[model samples]
Target: MVVEAKNTTSPHNMNQVDVNSDDRRDEQVPLLLQYWQAVSRYRIGIACIVLGTIALGIIVTLLMTPYYTATSRIEINRNQDKVTNVEGLEAEDVGQNLEFYQTQYALLEARSLADRVVRSENLATGDAFFQTFNVDPDENGIISGSDSRQSSEDRRRRFELAIRLLLDNVSISPVRGSSLVDVSFRSPDPQLSASIANAWVAQFVDSNLDRRFDSTIDARKFLEERLAQLRARLEDSERRLVRYADNKEIVTLSTTRDAEGSTVGGDTLISSNLAALNKALTDATADRIAAQAQADQNGLNKDAIENPAINGMRQKRAEIASEYAKILVQFEPEYPTAKALERQISDLDESIEKEELRMRTGALTRYSEALKRERNLQNQVAQLKSKFSGERQDTIQYNIFQREVDTNRQLYNGLLQRYKEIGVAGVGSNNIAVVDPALAPEQPSSPRILLNMALAMLMGLGLAGAYVVVSEQIDQTIKDPSDLKNRLNLAPLGSVPDMRKDDIISMLQDKKSVAWEAYISIQTSLSFLTSHGAPRSFLMTSTRPNEGKSTSAFALAAVLSSTNRKVLLIDGDMRNPSLHQMIDQKNVQGLSNYLSGDDDIDNLIQKMPDQGFWVMTAGPIPPNAAELLSSPRIKKLFDHLEEKFDCVIVDAPPVLGLADIPLLANAVEGVIYTIEAGGVKVRGIESALRRVRSSHATIFGAIITKVKSSGTGYGYGYDYQYSYGQQDPLPAPSA
Candidate 1:
């Protein structure tokens, strides 16, 4: 039994799963189709935006004035002609220095260069040139006035304005990794543009030459003044040296040096002589002191140290005294030998005194002469010192004068060399040279019509797309059925194609019509919500009125009745009844009458004559419809109807701002939410679904009403006219 139950329930479960899957996929179809739908609907507007913008661009380009650009190329390098680079005057290492190229570019665009170009080309007064800059030549000229001061001021202003305008038309661009510069001038006249470009280069070269010549002239004048001052200083220093040397009698001489290095010339004779005499005096004084010391130590034996003659005499006296003393011992008192010895001793003493006196006299004489010699030498030395002092002063002054002369001579030589260099460089030509002359352009540089139109087209397309996106964001309407499925996770039951009033009668009478076909699809989709294929009772409601929920109820009931099922349609709205008008039926007896204590269920339920179903119209408008729907009597009425009918369809009122829909939703098996195409906001539909779901109502699906055939429709590629025309006839019965 368990295995049999599993086998029997498996297919049912699988079918249920398939239904859920189809519901999810159907919900996604609308979102995927939205962009393409919008494009199809607004393709004309987008085309117009792009085409209009492109046309406008073309018109503007055609109307604009053409401008021609003429360019001249000039070379600027760190290198220059060797002849022109005298005394390191030319620029060097320009390629290595970053600022050097920048400075050159600045000079190329300088106001001075522009002014020179204007003058060379004579463009200041040219009407054509002034017109290019949008300045009136008459206004730029000196204003006419009686006052001389005002005229002069106006002339100056005019000149400045003209120069500024000239500068604006000139452009200088340096070629990267090269020494070339592109000098471009733009003007309405091709010939003028070329002429101005060429003129600017010529004037720049001339200006460079002038600058170099001026600098050279300044350098020469400065050197001349410096040379004159140095010459005067040199002459003055030489004169002072010569006069001082002559007055002091000093001569600078080349002399050979002796071992002791004493002066040998006659001018140094007295000083030399004084030096010799002083040396003699020093010897003589030394000798005298030695002699005196000897006398003091020797005393009576002084004759032996001083003189030989005195020594010999003293020896003889000594021998005689010895003989006399021997004789006195023999002959007593009157010996002649003793007398002779005494006398000899006396004679020796007398001779010794004389010799001593001679020696002393010689010593004193030598000492006195040495003193005289010393005094004479001292006098000579004093005279020589005075002469030498005068010569020394003269030598010092000569040295100072000689140094001044040397310094002046050095400066003079340097200035002379520099002066020669300047004279050579002053005649040198400029280094800036034109590599290419300007030529008139064949075509105008401005008004690129094709490119401008292309850009305009792109911009316009971008703007149009932005407009579409912004409109889509601002518009919260549920335009596509997929929008409900993707945003609210609700499955769409069907799309009710827009109906013209003339087709309404045929739509209800003919089951073969597109409206009948659409309702049949809705009926089939609702059949899958329950095991019995169709819910016993389902309520249909919308967010607001005129959303066609009542009509959908009538159509669905008719489709179900065509299948030979007993279907009941109820006009559940009591506040504002609308279902009776859809079927052209009388509203005298219906749901409101039965719910208000009149329980004639059989009589109140009237059969829709040709619809193959029964409809209970909302009999009258009620003040308290919410209270009536909420009563237990309404539930009992639905039970009784369900027992009699195979399917029940209730056309409930709009869900928002009312309690009747929520109460009716609670009594039904499932709820069918309806939305108007491009009518109600998605937020309003979501709020209506919220109210129904909060009452614990089962949401079977949603249907989009009043869908258009092309622009705002729900279906994709499902045209009724084509289908009805091309569809093959129903299979004939087998014969």
Candidate 2:
């Protein structure tokens, strides 16, 4: 049996081969190359899109209306007010606050400013600006003669409508880090654009100056009224203080220092008196202390006892004692003279004691008198302090009145100064000035022709690229041979370009053509499929009918016969045989008749004219074609044909859902699988291959039939070169 043994390698090994092949493909081929190839394939459609979009862009650019923009520059002074050299005048930097500059920009585009510009330009009557909005000249604009007599309400409405239109056309932007702003207006008329921009700047400056003047005037008037009120308040405060003091008899006195170095005024008169009485009480206390000390020392001090009465009594006692001593020395005893002397001395001693007692009593009396005087001074000091407390209450009210007077005076002075400064500032010139007036523009700002066309081309290419990618994603048809080898591991033997004809005879007859060249290459590849020489008996089949399987069979047989080899082309599809039609042979006595044992192989085979190939057409439609192909007798028939012919090519039926091809495949040395390019999906090829593989049939390789010639870079290139008179040597197809 020439058929190779079934693939004994495990499913795991086969899967690994597939996986490694996929990994190698991913590593070798870049994503960009794949995209480039796709773009190259579908470039015609993409070019159509780009050209169409560019044409549309050109038309739109021609139809668009042009607009001209005019701009005016103005400078704002943050310290404008400080330019004047007034003493109290200081400038405010409105630009220092974020919201301030934002507000200024807003004001530049304000409705009021717009209204002023409109009136100044007299754009409310029969102007292009108002007419663009379809506003009636009679109702919305103040026409010169007739409509001028419109009502006040009507005039105000027209003014408002014009202002809205002006604001819509105006734009304001501030220059960064500078006190400058750009005011721009866009209009169809260049002159109107410039005029409107200049008018807006002028109106903004006027409005700013008017606001400053009004604020100053209002401040002056308010200050005048405040100054009058403060003066009256000051006078009333002073008058109230004076009247209250007089009514309460609370006289204000000058502050003075007393002997104690403490401040003394009429406010402290009671306190001063109390201090004086305290000093007297201190003195009296000291006197009483000294007198008491003297009384305490009366028994111990000789000077204390030596008063006038005490000293005289002591002298009389001393004389009597001397006389008694003289009588004692003379008298015998109990004498009258001695007794009288002793009695006299005792009386003198009694009189001395009485004198000392009376002197001590006088010291006590002086001490008591000093204490009584100290008590009297303390009582007087307490009464004076009580009286001073009552007077302090009155002083509190007086202090309140004085503070009010001071506050009123200070406020009145501040207001008077501000009133003067504002009066000076109100006469100052406007700080905001136009730096550059708007001039009429020479060119339109919109509907750029070249730029629009460029953008449109870019957009068109983007859309077209997206369409190609999406179509490629949804389309499952095989585009080229590389996808088959990489995705399905099935290398195509050769690619047969679309023949543009239903008859295979025309393609076979036309040598040096793409279809003829493709099959020649296929025949060459068929020689290398087997290591010995070539596959002797191979089955030709496809995933479905009408995919060029029968045509390929006849062509391969013809090419094989050209190599001086006897070839036998058999139509194995008895159910729907097509080989007879391709070769213009009769099917009366063919494979079916031979298989049914009615006719011999020699009577069943037909010979082609001048072509060294034999054809065995399907004789009749059989009821069990698959069963007939599966019988042991089919193998006998193949073996007998192999001995007779150099190459036996069987045209088998489509493989999917049929038992015919797989049974035939099992007997042949190899199976030649054919798929239609851009016709069958990879899934269909895989399913048909699976069917052949299950029968243990060896797949020689695959062939992609009817590939589009453009961008395929397959056998079509060689045909093109040869047809154009180029004799380049083409390489043989690989196994």
Candidate of highest TM-score? 2
Candidate 1 is scored at a TM of 0.53
Using Cα atoms with residue i matched to residue i, what is each candidate's TM-score against the true structure? 0.53, 0.55
**Model 1 over residues 1-735: C-alpha lDDT tens digits?**
322332343355336535753764654545446766676666788888889889988998899888889999999866665465565455467546888779888988899887777677666544456666666545745433333444555555556776887688789998988889999988788998898888888898888778877888888899899988887887887787678767766555443334433222322333454456667657756766665554454344354465788778878888877787788778874666667677778988898878877776665565566556666666766776676666656566656665665666667777888878888874655557789999999998877888889898998888778767777788788765666666777766777776643364456686666677778777777767667777788889999998878778878888889889999999988778877777787778788888788988998888876778988899977678877888988878877888899988999889899888768876767788888877888788788888887776667778887776565544442464413654554221111
Best by lDDT: 2
RMSD of each: 19.5, 15.1
Off by over 4 Å in 2: 1-30, 34-38, 76-83, 86-93, 97-103, 132-161, 173-181, 214-416, 424-431, 462-476, 480-674, 680-735
Per-residue lDDT of model 2, residues 96-134, tens digit only? 677777778888877888877877888765446665544
Candidate 1 wrong stretches, greater than 4 Å:
1-36, 39-131, 135-185, 188-194, 197-459, 501-517, 622-624, 709-715, 720-735
